[model samples]
Target: MDRSEKTVLTNMCMIYDDDGNVLVQDRRDSDWGGITFPGGHVEKGESFTDAVIREVYEETGLTIETPQICGIKQWPEDDGSRYIVLFYKTSHFAGELKSSEEGEVYWTKLSRLKDLPLARGMELMLRVFLEDEVGEYYIYEEDGEWKHVLK
Candidate 1:
């Protein structure tokens, strides 16, 4: 069996408030509707930290302080393509929230995050972030069922 090549990537800013509420967005484009965090693909030559800061600023108009890595999610597609997404968290930021090509932004209370519609993988990831300590690394399969490879 041939294992698919994996693309290592970073998604920074599970932006949180002092109270621990996370920031979520509603994608304006059909390609990415519903609830999601503010982030995107890391550009070449750009560090993961820098990518997240830039993405957050572009998507939500917020300038985030350096984010701390929280978790890792692996999405392996059937077409032999895989995306290893690095998740980060940050509570320090500045600027007003605004809409962008990415989506409309909102700060969601951690307790109510599940009440909102979110990407399939997000619900589980959020739980891990809340229940666990400050930092951790987890690997998940792309299947609807999230299988953890690390704690």
Candidate 2:
């Protein structure tokens, strides 16, 4: 028996400043589109940490430092592959902030997130990024229905 499985790795980083604000990207694409952090898929042979760093730079034009792995969100794809997103947070960074074709990047108060139009499931993902107690967000199917949990 071959006990092997396929997986897709991705990442998202919440870059915060000294003030009570965080960097956000207003994605232009409809697929997974909305207000979210800057990140992208991890390429082959690249480390998770390196992937996040590169993705952030590509999308947000900021170079982050000492990015702390705060949590993760994982779900199963229809093709039996697992999709995973590594969550990171950092208050340390440098460089001019710019936006890519992916979205418009800007700094906003964390308290005002609820008022913004956020991407689906981002509300839960935010818990992982902001709360120290919660470290994981998982999605699974049961009885032909989708459900989720945070750990």
Candidate 3:
């Protein structure tokens, strides 16, 4: 029997400033609409780090430096394909902050994140990004019920 499966690669970055604020994008897309980090698909032939850097710049107009991979968020699609999101964080960046077609980008205090309307599953994803012990956030099915985990 064949056991190979297709996968999709994507990324997201949590950019921080000296003032304890993090950059967030108020996404306009309906699929995962609401507040989230700036990121996008990893193009074919692009390295994970490179893809995230390009994505951050395209969506936020700021070029990030030395982005560190913190964790991963993944889930299986209905068609049997898997979707994975590489999570990154960085404090070194340059360029004037500007919003792109994807959304309005701005800096907000980390403490205020809980007050805003976040994208679906974003709250759980944050656990992997912020907690040192959590390396992966994912969803799976068992006994016909879906379950989420942070490991």
Q: What residue pairs clash in candidate 1, if any at all?
A: none
Residue 131 in candidate 1 has what lDDT? Answer: 56
Q: List, residue by residue over 1-151, the lDDT tens digit for candidate 2.
A: 9987899999999999888999999999877889999999999999999999999999988999989999999999999999999999999889999999999999999999878999999999999998899999999999999999999
lDDT of 1: 0.76
User: Model 3: how far is 21 from its true place, Å?
Assistant: 0.2
Q: After superposition, how far is residue 113 of candidate 2 from its true place, in Å?
A: 1.1
lDDT of 3 by residue, 1-151 (tens): 9888899999999999889899999999978899999999999999999999999999988999999999999999999999999999999999999999999999999989878999988898878879999999989998999999989
User: Model 1: what TM-score?
Assistant: 0.79
Question: Mind sharing the TM-score for model 3?
Answer: 0.96
Point out the worst 10-residue segment of candidate 2 by lDDT. 26-35
Model 3's alpha-carbon lDDT is: 0.94
The 10 consecutive residues of candidate 1 with the worst lDDT sum are 133-142
